[model samples]
Target: MSQRKRSIITASLLATTLLAASPALLAGNHSSHHGDNQHDMTEMCDNMREGKGHFNKADRQEKMAEQREAMANRLKLSDEQREIWSEMHEEKRQQHEKRMGKWQKKMDERCAQSQK
Candidate 1:
């Protein structure tokens, strides 16, 4: 019935509500669906969080090279096709970066607006 006790109970309830709403806080804004790649990417992220992500640059390159080779084989691309594909891939990568940069800028502007 004390004032201090009531303040403590209110603070605890607010903390619980915030924690429950944490995941929904970032929902819909940043969820990207990459089809079949989503599961593999999630696993890779888990590995990174667990520190088994091969932080060494050389080791990372080796693993990435292997994965790329496997992917090329899976797609059954010829050497000439791979060369052309690489060029197109690079273009797509640049386009993706540009789009993401724009998205980030908009998100920053929205956050600034919200703060005001």
Candidate 2:
């Protein structure tokens, strides 16, 4: 037929091929990263803290400190970078403490009201 029709047909074929291949391409990429053991929901269910149970605020701070050390080691952070990281972490901790203080005050007020 016309050149325009031929161009349209070629474009349509390319688009169809890509659409057909997309899911398989994505699945392959995802599986390649994790490999063989894909579904971990059964194991994840064992950790209720990860799903529904309330995580302890005290434990969170301790875990964050541990994770920060692990992360610094993994990244091979420089001395200056480590200093900055510590400062950032301290600032975050102070903010968290302030938030917790506000939350405790609210909780105390509610308790006092209920008791009256």
Candidate 3:
């Protein structure tokens, strides 16, 4: 092979190798970010449970109201549709509360076990 051809081939191989390794490198970076996110989420949850964060009942209620208003405006719902939306929203709220209750129980158990 000529010198130019050999250089081109070497460059192509290097590029291919780097491309193949890039995803693994990127995935490692993503995993580190995921870990950080998990830590942040856990800390936030702890603060909320301890009533140390902006996680009070009034704040939560206000946020929920804002969300509902945003959704209503975005959907431009009719009166009937608004009623249906309200019903669905209430159902979802109940379901979410139930799920959160279970999660809180699990977290409490986990914390209790860790303390022992």
Off by over 4 Å in 2: 1-58, 114-116
Score candidate 2 by TM-score against the native. Answer: 0.46
CA lDDT for candidate 2: 0.73
Clashing pairs in 2: none
Q: How displaced is residue 48 in candidate 2, in Å?
A: 20
Per-residue accuracy of model 2 over 1-116 as CA lDDT, tens digit each: 99999999999999999999998887755655465333343333334325333335667777889999999999999999999999999999999889977876775575455446
lDDT string for model 1 (1-47, tens) is: 99999999999999999999988986764445555455665555555
- For model 3, residues 1-116, the per-residue Cα lDDT tens digits are 99999999999999999999998887654667877876676776677568665657667877888999898989999999999998998899899889988987887776555446
Top model number, TM-score: 3
Q: Please report the candidate that would top lDDT against the real structure.
A: 3
Q: What's the TM-score of every candidate structure? A: 0.37, 0.46, 0.60
> lDDT of all predictions, in order shown?
0.70, 0.73, 0.81
**Candidate 3, pairs of clashing residues:** none
Give the Cα-based TM-score of candidate 1 against the true structure: 0.37
lDDT, residue 40, candidate 2: 40
Which model, 1 or 2, shows the larger lDDT?
A: 2
Listed per model in order, the count of residue pairs whose N, CA or C atoms clash below 3 Å is: 0, 0, 0
